[model samples]
Target: ERGLLCALALSREQFVTPGHALVLRLVRLSAEATAPHVEPALLAQKPLLDRHGNAPVYVAQNLLEQLAARFEFSASDDEFQAYRKCLRPRSLDENAPRPLVGRAIELLQFKAVIEATQECQDGHVVYVRGMAGIGKTRLVSEFLEM
Candidate 1:
């Protein structure tokens, strides 16, 4: 009964609905009956339960705190400095758009293949294979512009 109450309360906190609130109330009543007798004053003093007797917000808060503490990371200054030393900085104009050159014929061929595929219902795969920095990306960029 306690577990069921807890599950319902957590669900209610995540996605509130009248149905969940109703079920939670029913479960809480059942849980109260099954629980060992305790004074009303003492029950009210319990930190986990709220005025309505549901602890969903408290439980969720504690769960998140525990998870954050468990996964918290703190790197030392020396470690951070060492990690930074291995990084490569990019040039200011590395991503600047440049006009494609000397690949007009390849670009036209790529466009023709793409147009041919559009006319058919079947799927087609196009592979642009070339050595590194051989203008494959540039050709594709130019083709897309057309």
Candidate 2:
């Protein structure tokens, strides 16, 4: 978080800038540091960087080494197609409903879903059904935000 914040401030660009290599090195070091506590399954699931030319690994290592020598980290991809998959920004569908404010009444439906799940012995799906202009999506979005 600290390094990203530093990069964000330093770059001052509108879009995501390069410095991702630093994040990878930091996560790698953190995972190694916390290896004992983390499950093998979790580490196995993590994406690994092979020796490739997407982004230079040596540059990342040098930056990490330089930064590590200066200050401690107190706070905190693949090929072209793979990189796109990894770095793609979450885009909302054109018809996706936007969240509506001042919708406290919608929370009752959320609570009902929660209560139903608690009482059920078997797993069940709580489908939010409603017609157009109704606030079903908005209600669910609010519930998730909460």
lDDT of 2 by residue, 1-146 (tens): 24534543433442322322322223345544654423222332344464232321111333444444333332212222111111221344757654455677668766776778889854667677889977776677778887
Candidate 2 displacement at residue 29 in angstroms = 67
At residue 7, candidate 2 shows an lDDT of: 43
> lDDT by residue for model 1 over 1-146, one digit each (tens)?
24334544465465532222222112236644786333322322334323343332112222223223222222322412211110111233656665565687887787777778888755677799999988787777677788
Candidates' C-alpha lDDT: 0.42, 0.43
Reference-based lDDT, residue 34, model 1: 80
Candidate 1, pairs of clashing residues: none
Model 1: C-alpha RMSD to truth? 20.9
* Candidate 2, poorest ten consecutive residues by summed lDDT: 80-89
Total backbone collisions, model 1: 0
In candidate 1, where is summed lDDT lowest over 10 consecutive residues? 80-89
What is the C-alpha local distance difference test score of candidate 1?
0.42
